[model samples]
Target: MDLFTYYRSTSSYRVRIALALKGLDYQAIPVNLLRDGGEQLKPEYRAINPQGRVPSLRTEAGRVITQSPAIIEYLEERYPEVALLSSDLIVRASQRAVAALIGCDIHPLHNVAVLNRLRGMGHDETEVIAWIAHWISEGFNAVEQLIGDDGWCFGASPSVADVYLLPQLYAARRFNVELSACPRILRVEQLALAHLAFQQAHPDAQSDKPA
Candidate 1:
């Protein structure tokens, strides 16, 4: 398997964490989202993924999968030995809800394309940072509540929610979102970051991370 990813992309980070948790071995192909007006938009990459997005997975069977959630789901479904989702049906749905809150509801509004578009439309850096902070805080408030007093989001072990949430927290810190009030969230982040899987999958651990 080949994972085409950018080190700083939260979406890419989620897939990396899942892969690490599953103990799957894959080649990490760097898609530098910053260099030369973004390598993800290049003709060669666009051919591999028409959407021109990072974290595209090319399986050994020559199948290409796009989108972080799709790839994670594929990994979960194909390799159930490590079980990122809960076996309990309702708990599983709740876990998916938390993942969606971060992956879908919040991350998109602050994605590079959205931020770049905001800049193009005359938003200043401070305003853009405010935009990011607003959504993260609002989103994390609910996340903090949902995550409640658990080592992971839904249990003693990290689940799909934890995989998605940890990356969002990384984004929150990068953009200076205030997390001091959310102790539960901070604890979860600390616990998840301390885990070997997450440690291995961190942005700094990536081969493409800039010094």
Candidate 2:
């Protein structure tokens, strides 16, 4: 398997965490999102992922998979030994709700493209930063209530919620969102940081991170 990834990309970070937790091995093909006028926009990369996004997975049989959620679902289905979701129907739905809350509601508002678009529309740095913080705080407020108070998001083991939450936390901190009110979320971050899977999949651990 080959993964086209950008080290700092939260979407790529989620996929890396999922792969590591599942104990899957794959070659990392760094796609420098900022180099040479954004490599992902280049023709070469568009051929790999027409959407020109990072975290495209090329499977062993040479099939390409795009989008982090879809790739993660594929991993969970294909490698069931270390399940990222619960077997209980209601619990699975709850876990997926948390993942979607972060993946869809929170993360995209502050995405590079969105931020760039805001800048294009004459929003200044302070305004863009405020925009990021607003959405993250709004979503995290709900997430703090939805998740459990103890280890991990749902229970003793990591779930799809954990995989999704950690990356969004990284983004939150990157944009300097105040997290004082989200103690439950911070506790989960503390536990995840100690886990080997999360450690290995961290942005700093990626080969393409800047010096």
Candidate 3:
């Protein structure tokens, strides 16, 4: 597998964590999102993914997959040995709810495109940062209640919820969203930092991370 990724991209980070947790070996193809006015917008990358997004997975058979959620779902189904979702029906739904809450509701609000649009609309840095923080704090406040109190988000083991939540938590901290109110999330963060899979998949551990 070849993973086209940007080190600091939370979407890429989530896929990395999923891959690591599944113990899958793949080539990491770094696409620097910030280099030369964003490499993802270049013709070469656009050819691979017309949307020009990072975290595009190319399988050994030369099939390419896009979108983090879809890629993660493919990985989860393809490699069931390390299940990210629960077998129980209700539990699985709850886990997916958390994933949607972050992926759809929270992450998109602070997406680069959204922030850039805000800037284009004449919103200054302070306002943009505030926009990022407000949504993250609001979403996380709900996530804190949805997840488990101890260990991973769903239970003792990591789930799709944890896979999704951790990346958003990273983004929250990156935007300096106050997290004192989300103790459950903080505890999950601590656990994830200690987990080998999460450690290996972290943005700082990626080869393309800046010096």
Candidate 4:
């Protein structure tokens, strides 16, 4: 299997964590998102993923899977031995809810594309930075309120939600969101940061780290 990913993409980071947790062996095919007007938009990479997004996974069976959530669900289904989703229906729904909070609700607003669009519309750095902070704080407030003081999102074991949460949290930190506002998340993130799976999957730890 080959993962076509950008070194700093949060979506790619989520998939990497999933792969590490599942203990799967795969080749990393780095597609530099910032080089040459973003290689993800180039024809060669677009042939692999027309969406021009990072984390297009080529499975062992030679299928091209796009979208991080779909790819993760595929991994969970194919490698059920690791068991990312909860067996209980309500618990699983809660997990999916938390995952969607980050994946769908929070991330899209703060994505590079959105920020670039803001820039194109005559928004200055201060405006763009405030835009990112506002949306992230909105999402983080919800997560902070719901998370409580637990080791994980739902149960003690890390679930699919954590996979989504961690990367968004990383992005939030990059934007300088105040960690003190979310004690539960800060604690959980610290624990995840210490774990080998999270450490190995960090953006800086990737082979294509910027010099």
Candidate 5:
């Protein structure tokens, strides 16, 4: 398997964490998102993923899969040896809700494309940072309320929902979103940070980290 990724992308980070948790041995192919007018938009990379997105996965069968959520779901479904979703239907629904709150709502609003658009419209760095902070805080506060104080989003063991949340929290800190009020989320983040899978999947741990 091969994963085409960019270091700081939370989407890519989510997939990386999933792969690590699954104990999958895959090759990392870094595609710098910023250099040379964004390599993800380059013709070569687009051929692999016309969406020009990071974290595209190529399986052993040489089939390409895009979208972080889709890739994570594929891992959970295909490699169910170590379950990432709860056995109970209701618990699974709750976990999926948490994942959707972050993936569908928070992520799209603060993605690179949205920030770049703001900059293009003449928003300065401070303004751009403010925009990011506002959205993340609003979204995270709601999510934290939903999360409560548990090791994982649902109950105990790490689930697919957690694999999605931790990376988004990393982005929250990067954009200066105050998390002191989000004790539940902060607790989960700390727990996940201590785990090997999460540690190995950090942006700084990537081979593409800039010197």
Candidate 6:
């Protein structure tokens, strides 16, 4: 397997966490998001993923999978020994919901593409930064209300929800979103850092991390 990834991509980070938790080893194919007018957008990469996204995973036998959620779901289904979802149906649904809350809801609004689109529309840096902060705070409010205060999002083990949440927390800090009110979320973030999977998947640990 080969993972086409960019260091700072939150979506890519989620996949890395899932892969590590599954105890899978794959070749890291770095796609520098900041070099040569963004490598993901280049013709060579577009052929690999027309969407030009950060995470494009090619299976060992050469099946390309795009989108973080789909890739994680595939991993969960294909490699079930270390399940990322809860056994209980309701709990599993809740786990997926939290993951989507961040992945589908919050991150999309703050991703580099969206910000660049905002810039193209004549939005200034101040306005763009404010936009990112506003969206993250709004999302964190929902997360704070739902997630428990502990090391994990669901139980003793980190679920798909935690895989998703940690990356957004990274984004929150990057955008300077105040998380003081979200004590549970912050607590989980602190605990997650101590875990090997999370640490291994951190942006700083990526091969593409800036020097």
TM-scores for the candidates: 0.98, 0.99, 0.98, 0.97, 0.97, 0.98
Residue-wise C-alpha lDDT for candidate 5, range 1-211, written one tens digit per residue: 9999998999999999989988999999999989988999999999999999898999999999999989999998889977888899988888889899999999988899999999999999999999989888988888888875767777778888888898899898887788999888888888898999999999989999998
lDDT per residue, candidate 2, 63-179, as tens digits? 999999999999999999899999999989999999999999999898889999999999999999999999999999999999997888999999999999999999998989999
Q: Is candidate 2 or candidate 4 better by lDDT?
A: 2
Predicted structure 1: lDDT: 0.93
Over 74-174, each residue of candidate 3 has an lDDT whose tens digit, in order, gives: 99889998899999999999999999999999998988878999999999999999999999999999999998877888888999899988899899889
* Candidate 1 clashing pairs, residues 3+ apart or interchain: none
> For residues 74-149, what per-residue lDDT tens digits would candidate 6 score against the true structure?
9999999889999999989999899989998899999988999999999999999999999999999998888876
User: Please, what are the lDDT tens digits per residue for candidate 1 over residues 1-211?
Assistant: 9999999999999999999999999999999999999999999999999999988999999899999999999999999988999989999999999999999999999999999999999999999999999999999999988875857888888899999999999999999898988998888888976799999999999898888
lDDT: worst 10-residue window of model 6: 146-155
Task: Candidate 2: give the clashing pairs.
Answer: none
lDDT string, candidate 4, 1-211, tens digits: 8999877899999999999888899999999988888999999999999999889999998999999999999999999877778899988988888888889988989877898999999999999989888888899889887664667877787889889989998898898877687888888898898888888888989999887
Model 1, position 200: C-alpha lDDT score: 96
Stretches of model 4 off by over 4 angstroms after superposition: none
Which one wins on TM-score? 2
How far in Å is the alpha carbon of 90 misplaced in model 3? 0.6
**Candidate 2 CA-lDDT value:** 0.95
Which segments of model 1 are wrong by more than 4 Å?
Answer: none
In model 2, which regions exceed 4 Å deviation? Answer: none
TM-score of 6: 0.98
Q: List residue ranges in candidate 6 displaced over 4 A.
A: none
Candidate 4 to truth, TM: 0.97
Better of 2 and 5 by lDDT: 2
